[model samples]
Target chain A: MNEILTQSVFFGMFLTLACFEIGLWVKKKAKIAIANPLLVAVILIVAVLTLFHIDYENYKKGADYIQYFLTPATVSLAVPLYRQLSYLKKYPLAIIGGIAAGVLTAMGSIFLLSMAFGLNHEQYVTLLPKSITTAIGMGISDKMGGMAAITVIAISVTGITGTILAEAVCKLFGIREPVAKGLAIGTSAHALGTSKAMEIGEVEGAMSSLSIVVAGIMTVMSVPLFATLIQ
Target chain B: MKFLRQIAIIMGISFLAELLEALIPLPIAASMYGLVLMLLGLVTKLIPLEKVEGAADFLIEIMPLLFVPPTVSVIANLEALKSILVPLLVICISTTILIMAVTGRTAQSLMRIGRSGGEKQESRTVDCGKNKMKNKLATGEEEKTDE
Candidate 1:
């Protein structure tokens, strides 16, 4: 079974899709934030590989095919941003300022914490892009010589944290305005947070999706500047 | 055929962005360039929304699934990550909450300031009234849906 699976070039791709579908079903049934499809899929894939004693490299061989779409998908984020352009026009300062502040806070906090904890430069850079979408974050981390896998893990954790805490944080901060609520979630958590934002309201959903693009662009531009801090 | 064309356009832009990344001395990622280029194209009407909408939506839909492979690699590197796991968790959770608070407050205040400043103008009342009605309707529906 192991040999057959390893030899099949499409095994990893098939497994990923199948696991993700199961993840979708679980999310649909569970109706909870913790049941994030990506999180579920990751855990399921990890379990399957370990239980079957499949080598990571062999799985990665087929998995790389799916990973190839990541870049184009990142580029495709423009569509949603474009659709939400009206929100940008209506509250340019609020949206832009909110995302800018959030992006800065994300990077600043990571830098300070990394320093306080005595993390090395590579680890610092890896954590730098933790708050943005995984697609763009992975690219930034890779370009900066950080461990992309660690960066991916950090991004996922940040996203899940954002999704779970979104309501509590909003209430705690008294963020009544839909725009503010959306911006806060997207800036802090990326697309995962946007999922929760969509559930909250339409305007919040629009704003959250908008923030993903702006925050992504802002992070991509600013990561280099921040990366110089720890080095 | 239409979907294939849409994908071709996206890939073509990605290819161009890759070239730009290699040519430019800046540390910008190729994906950034592609995103900027795509946004610009859409804004300028160089690429109509119809042309890329289908493929773009499809791509975004499956985006999370694409990250599974890279994330799964974490298992192989668990040993190295163990030492810093506590700190990593601390930073991710703390900063996420902190960012949400800071961003929410900043935007809320700024929006309030804008509203107050605009409210004094008599000419804006009509627009404000319409907006208020819209908000009321939206919140009303939201409350109903909540139950």
Candidate 2:
């Protein structure tokens, strides 16, 4: 069993697909936001690997095939951004300013909080770019000598948490405008939260898509500067 | 065949972005360059939105699945993570709320300020309408379902 798990590429591929499908099924059955497919898949994969004592490196060989698509997937995001260009032109300053503010706040708060939390340099660096998309965030994290894998995990957790709480947060903050809601979600949670924002309405989807682009660029540009400041 | 071409175009743009990333001194990711380049292409009519919509839809729809492996790799750093998990969780959740509240409120205020002078923005609205129509004409069939 160990040999098959370690040596067979099909083993990892099958496990990942099966776990994701099962996660989808569970999400359908439970109908709860917390039963997110990504979250479910992560939990199941971690549990199974731990129980079987299968090494992460072995699992990653096949999984990396899926990971390879992340760059293309991220690039393709520009299509939606392009489609939403009209909205971008109409409210350029508001979107740019909001994303810039969110980026700065996200970086500042994470840097200070991580330091206060007594996390080491590696962990602090990992947590800094947690709000941006994986492709960009991973780049910044890697360049700064942070753990890319840890940044990936933190990014997912931050995305899921934001998606789950976005509506409540908006309501609590009295944020009624669709544009504002969308910007907030995308700026803070990146793609996953933007997916949720899409479900809310058309204007929200457009605004969220715009925020994803602006916030991604802002975070990529500013995270290094913030890193140097905090270090 | 059309979808394949669309994918090729997106990948080609990504390659250009990779090249730009290597050339640029800043820490900008190749994906950001790809995104900005794609936006430039669309704005300049170099690549119409129709050419990429199908491939883009497929890619974005499955993006969450792509991150699963990385998320699971968290198991490898369990010891380090376990100690910092609480603080990390606190920081993530609080910062998310803070970002959302701050950005949302700021955008709302800015939009209000814009709207105060936005009545004279008739030309921009018409410009957007013309662009939307052009986009609709380009992706007429898609507009039936997606718009």
Candidate 3:
């Protein structure tokens, strides 16, 4: 058992899965908003790896093996997407128009704020894709000459920020429209924040989910235009 | 057998989509190019929504797995996190709060519109129809049905 468990690939998967399942249990028992399962597992896995002193490479060997699932999962997201098709079609024009406005406003806001704060060119590039899903954000960062490391950093930071503050921001602005709320966070922070949005209500989750796909499209469309415009 | 074929086709499209921008000599990554092709495919109805729906749903269900590498990296960069933990905490919390506010308010407002606008229209239509039907029905029979 030790032999199998200690193998980096096996250990990482076992640990990741085990921690994830345990996170579910924690969520059940604690009933605390802060005790989100993913956050819990993230903390647990990090602690386990640290405790064993196995170092991350060995741990990653296990994780990377499981990580292959991420791409397929991304592709498979079309399932709920299909389920939501009718809902999407119901107000296609409003959704498309609203999402475009929200995404552009999000980007514009961040860009303006960053510029005011003296963000350099590299940081600007990193911040540009902060609202996208992390994989895409990382991809954009690498392709556009922003540091991959910084992009990931910004993505995670954006996610956690979105998670904690989505409602506060909405209320502060009196933006009680579900579409607006969902679009705002999903546009600016992507999946991590979207997960938090799910907790507030089903409509928000659906809207935020919609935001993810639309915002991905918006970001992808805008980057090239920005590249040309900047050059 | 049918589902398997569907999965394969979807994956194939996804793969094709991934590699589409290789022809471009632009500074952007090929995958980014692929996304464009995918969008075009989607827009053009070349790849129907159902074709990718199964796969896309599967991807989101297991979304956390995708973050494994970075999570491991977190372990690797334990020292760095310790250094920036405060900022990280602040950022995550602030953003989350903001998002929650926006989403909740939007849902409430939409719910209001749906409730108010839809209720009045439905009531007007249904009430008028119901009154007409009631007027045609015998009063005794209507009272019995109501009871």
Candidate 4:
């Protein structure tokens, strides 16, 4: 069985999609933020691989095809951002400043905490881009000599946390405005938080998507500068 | 055929962005370059929204699935993560809440300021109009005011 599965060109891809579909179904039935399809799929896939004692490399063979779409997906983010450009025009300063504040806070907090925790430079850099999307964050992590896989994990955890706590945080902070709410989520949690923002309202959804793009670009530009602080 | 063409355009931009990443001295990602290029094309009307909207939306919709493989690979690195797990969790959760609070407040306050400023300007204009109407009534130009 192992030999057959390993030799088949489509096995890994099949497993990935199948698991993801199951995850989607679970999320639909659960109706909860914590039941994130991506999270579910990751756990399912990891369990299957471990139980079967299949090598990670063999699974990666077909899974790499799915990963290939990441670039196009990242590029496609521009569509929503463009669609939300009207909001930018309406509250240009507020929107820009909100996202800027979020980005700065994300980097600054990580830097200070990592220093306090005595994290090495590489570890610190890996967490620097945690608040941004995986596609961009992974790139920043890899370029800065941090572990990309760890960065991916950190990003996923951060996103899930954002999704779960978005509303409570807003209420606590008195962030009543829809645009500000969206910016807060997107800046802190990336696309995953944007999903929660979309659930909140249309304006929030638009602003959240806009924040993903703006915050991503800002993080990419500023990460190099922040990386120098710990090193 | 249309979907195929749209994907081709997106892939073309991505490829160009890859080339730009190599040629440029900056540390920007190819994906970032692609995003900016796509936005510029759209904003300039060089690329019609309909040209890429369908494919782009489809791609974005399935984005979560794309990250599955990369994330699952984390299992292989669990050893390295074990030691720092506590600190990592602390930072991720704490900073997430902190960022949300800071960003939400900054945007909310700035928006309030912008709104108040706009309201003040609007009231000033209204006051000027009222003063003009009073002057016209005093001059027996009430007919113009009514018109």
lDDT pick, better of 1 and 3: 1
Q: lDDT of model 4 at residue A91?
A: 78
lDDT of 4 at A134: 81
Model 3, residue A192: displacement in angstroms?
3.4
Instruction: Give Cα-based local distance difference scores for all models.
Output: 0.82, 0.79, 0.57, 0.82
Looking at model 1, the pairs that clash are: none
Candidate 2 structure quality by residue, lDDT tens digits, A1-231? 677767778777778888999988998999887888888998999889889888887898788888777777777767767666677777777888888889889999998898788877777887898998886788788888787877877888888898888888887766666778889998999887877787787577667767777887788777778777555
DockQ score for model 2: 0.34
Residue by residue across A13-81, what tens digits does model 4's lDDT show? 999999999999998999886788888999999999999898888898899999888777778877877
- lDDT by residue (B32-114, candidate 3, tens digit) is 33334544566577877776655555555556445645645765655535644454444434433433443343333343344
Ranking the candidates on lDDT from highest down gives: 4, 1, 2, 3
> In model 2, what is the error at residue A138, expressed in angstroms?
1.9
- Reference-based TM-score of each model: 0.84, 0.87, 0.69, 0.86
Q: How are the candidates ranked when ordered by DockQ, highest leading?
A: 1, 2, 4, 3
What digit string (tens of lDDT, one per residue) describes model 1 on residues A49-132? 999899888888899999888779878877877877776786788888888999999889899999999998898998999998
Return the top candidate by lDDT: 4
lDDT of 2 by residue, B1-147 (tens): 999999999889989989998999766678778878887898899999899989988887787788788788888888767877887789888999899888887776566556555542332222233234432232221221121
DockQ comparisons of all candidates to the true complex = 0.41, 0.34, 0.16, 0.32
RMSD of each: 5.6, 8.2, 9.8, 9.1
Which pairs clash (backbone N, Cα, C closer than 3 Å) in model 4?
Answer: none
- The Cα error of candidate 1 at residue A193, in Å, is 3.2
